[model samples]
Target: MVDNRVNPTSNMKLLLYNQVDGRCPFCGKNLHYVKNQIQTLLEIAHIYPANPKSHEAELLKDVPRLSEDVNSMENLIVACRDCHKKFDHPRTAEDYYRWYDLKKELMLNDEAKSAFFDNNVEEDIIKVMDSLLKIECESDLVQLSLSALKLDEKINKENSFIFRKKIRDQVVDYYPMVREQFNELDAISPYQFEKIATQVKGCYLTLIKINENQEAVFRMLVAWLDEKTGKISSLACEIIISFFIQNCEVFS
Candidate 1:
């Protein structure tokens, strides 16, 4: 039988390496080593066998595939040569699922990271952050009852209990002030609040397209806001994201 394997392009190889952060996804070994000079030990392995023998094909016949196209980026991963060899010669259903799941995670992470470069929120969000920071008086904050919190409705079941609690705390503490800040901004400059809300919505849309997981989306929104606000305060960013969630700007 003719071998159908084809070498991935230079750009494809680079992308595979980057998706796994220059380490073997299977073995956690560095994809390259610099002994005398740079020596690459990475091998691109297909999640779905490119040219499977009859038995290999039968073993994975019922398993879901990342891509029908054998060499597509979705079906490829960078592994150390040892893992690549081991994964190919004796592929099992368990191994196939493991590799497929790992590749999917890496792809999602890459997409989330890429969104940081592709999208930017309005700078006015920083004003809201400043307002949050200036709340010197505990009486200044108006906490909403847990029954009124929107996070319970918007957060998915897949999210951890701790994350749910953290978001709940942020929203309960900061939602009122954030909403007030937006109201003040709108009163001062008509549509300024709308502009920021729309930008946050846009970022959320981009993130959901990458991964529909609520926890992942929420974390990405916080990270994106942190980046946009010059990394001033992660807590401030989380509060702002929680405000958006409550205001129906995201996770709806």
Candidate 2:
């Protein structure tokens, strides 16, 4: 995996990150927010060399309007440090083809699309959100979170059609509202989401100190299931616990 540090100046890095969902598209390594002290490993890589003096960039000189697009979203991608360097080395034409193949693989993902339609939609949401949190650039974090939500909604369009409609119809039940709010990030915007994440993150760290084992964490989480308040509270607690357990690795 590429471990090169990224510059704080570039918004394109984050934009590229949002495009690939915040991981190395080629190696599938966790790029965003994986470390504690050090900077992120993900960086913006232009498919066509951005430098006008470079041979690869020169090749595009004959192609109309394409050379100018070297810095455009269509031409930029997120890559790990190693991949970024390797992409710049030898066999420019062959590397471009290989890069294109990797790009296709990233875009045409069946698993991410299928998960949205499957029983694991919540898990999928958390996964994408986790990536958003891990991003090195803090600029427009909420915007990036919102984009991730929209991308998921775009996936499995046909499958989500009926359920999305049902969500639209059902107002009282959060089933629809939860999906809609997340899709739009309206009801609880990304900033609000970050606040919750911060609170929960503190709680999670405390839990680890108390007991590092999963069983201990589950028992503590189970305390809420016994709440005399109501079933909704219990259900909410369960959902929280499930998300924390499933993504405990995100923080560490």
54-99 per-residue lDDT for model 1 (tens digits): 9998998999988888988898999999999998877888989999
**Over 4 Å off, model 2:** 1-12, 33-35, 52-54, 57-68, 104-252
Residue 117 lDDT, candidate 2, scale 0-100: 39
Q: In candidate 1, where is summed lDDT lowest over 10 consecutive residues?
A: 115-124
Worst 10 residues of 2 by lDDT: 142-151
Candidate 2 backbone collisions, by pair: 2-81, 2-82, 33-134
TM-score, every prediction: 0.51, 0.35
